[model samples]
Target: MWIGSAAVCLDDKNRILMIQGKDLVEWAVPSGGLQENESLEDCCIREVKEETGYDVQIIKNLFIKEGQAEGGIHYQTHYFEVKLIGGDANINDPDGLNI
Candidate 1:
């Protein structure tokens, strides 16, 4: 099983900050798998910044989803509301796929 976190960042105009995911190429909230020893709050902030180049402050957990895959792999995702702090939107990452 794997645990992941996502950030739902809202802008001043009430627009949600969605990224063009590298793998899925779909517009979705910034999210990623949690790193070892990393807190969920830190994961949310880091994932958002890595994907959208926007630093965020997680406000609260919004929801949790759990499920299983065909290969018996289980997954859990935690979603949180976040506020943008700083950073410029950059959809380019040389070492990995980017939005």
Candidate 2:
């Protein structure tokens, strides 16, 4: 099973913050798989910072989606509403994927 977390942030204009990695054709919220010994919320916050260069605080958990994909891979993703705390809007992904 693959476990992940996603961060949802909205600006004052109600525009959702989205990111597109170099390998992804579609835009998506800042998200990533959970790392060892890390909480889901931490994963969400870290992913947002890594992908978008934004520090955020979790406001609330929006929802969780769990399902099985083709080839029998099961996945669960937790979605959370977050508020920006600091950092500028820029790509600082250590993996060099986000653009």
Candidate 3:
């Protein structure tokens, strides 16, 4: 099982920062799995930064979900509400786009 953290990055305009994965082409919150010894909060912050180029402050844990995908891979996902601290909405990696 893989554990991952996602962010609903809300801005002053009430717009959420969503990302479009190059592979998936679906809009989703910026997210990624935790590294060894990484806290959930840290993972959320790091993932958001890596995917969206935004420094985010986690406000609160919002939801947790688990399910099996088509390929039989199980996923455990954690979602959090976060506020953007700094950084532009630039895509640091070509794998995804900040929308």
Candidate 4:
């Protein structure tokens, strides 16, 4: 099983932030697998910054999503609502999932 974290960011206009992977045509929340020795909240914050170039702080955890994929790979994801702190909007995904 794999565990991951996702960020739910909102602007002053109440619009939710979303990102598109370089290889994906669909839009999705900024998310990533939790790194070793990292807290779930830290994982969520890191993913948002990496994917969207936005520094954020966790407001609260929203929910958890668990399921199995076609390959029977079980996964658990933690979602959190985060507040924007600082940083310019740009893509800098280390996974090269952004151009």
Candidate 5:
């Protein structure tokens, strides 16, 4: 199973912060699979900073879901509302994804 965590941040105008990256896929909130021993909150914060260069604090868990994709790939994802603490809006994704 793929365990993931995503961060939800809103702009000053209350617009949702979405990212369009190298995948050329649909725009999505900053998210990724968790590393061993990493908490969901930590993973959410790390993914947001890594993908969008924004330091974030996990405010709360907005929702959690699990699903099975084609080819039997299962996923468990957690979404959290986050507060921006610092950092620029520039992208510097460790995975080479552009924001």
Candidate 6:
């Protein structure tokens, strides 16, 4: 099962949160694949922190996207709108992601 999440985080000023794509070299929202032994909510929180260093609270789910790839790998992604609870915003890629 392929499961992942992406967060559409906005600030009080209505500015959207974005990150430079580590692979694609374009601006994109923060997202990541789910890890073992963690809830989906936890994955979202962790991914945001790992990629952008911002702590967040998942307000609610926005949508769910499911599809199949070329090799017939079924993939699912959960999108969420989040609020900033704390933490600074900056790049802190744990996996050394670079464009």
Q: Per-residue lDDT tens digits of candidate 4, residues 1-99?
A: 999999998889999999876677898899999999999999999999988888999999899999998899999999999999999998886886553
How well does candidate 2 score on lDDT at residue 15?
A: 98
Count clashing pairs, candidate 4: 0
Candidate 2 lDDT, 1-99, residue by residue in tens:
999999999989999999876877899888999999999999999999988888999999999999998999999999999999999987886776647
Once superposed on the true structure, which residue ranges of model 1 sit more than 4 Å away at CA?
22-25, 92-95
Q: What is the lDDT of every predicted structure here?
A: 0.84, 0.92, 0.84, 0.91, 0.88, 0.86
In candidate 5, list every pair of residues with a backbone clash.
none
All candidates in order of TM-score, best leading? 4, 2, 5, 1, 6, 3
Candidate no. 6 TM-score: 0.85
lDDT of 6 by residue, 1-99 (tens): 699999998777989988886457578788889999988888999999988889999999999989997889999989999998989867776777762
* lDDT for residue 10 in candidate 1, whole number 0-100: 81
Highest TM-score: give the candidate number.
4
TM-score of each: 0.86, 0.90, 0.85, 0.93, 0.89, 0.85
Q: What is the lDDT of candidate 1?
A: 0.84
| Candidate achieving higher lDDT, 5 or 6 | 5
Tens digits of per-residue lDDT, candidate 1, 1-99, equal: 989999988878999988774578468788889999999989898888778788888889999989997899999989999998888987645337745
Which prediction has more favorable TM-score, 2 or 6?
Answer: 2
> Model 5, 1-99: lDDT tens per residue?
999999889978999878896658789888999999999999999998888888998788899989998999999999999989999987776766455
Give all candidate RMSDs, comma-separated: 2.1, 1.5, 2.6, 1.2, 1.6, 1.8
Distance from true location, Cα of 4 in model 6, Å: 0.6
**Model 3, residue pairs in steric clash:** none
Cα misplacement distance, residue 93 of candidate 5 (Å): 2.6
Clashing pairs in 6: none
- The parts of candidate 3 lying over 4 Å away from their true place are 94-99
Model 4 poorest 10 in a row by lDDT: 90-99
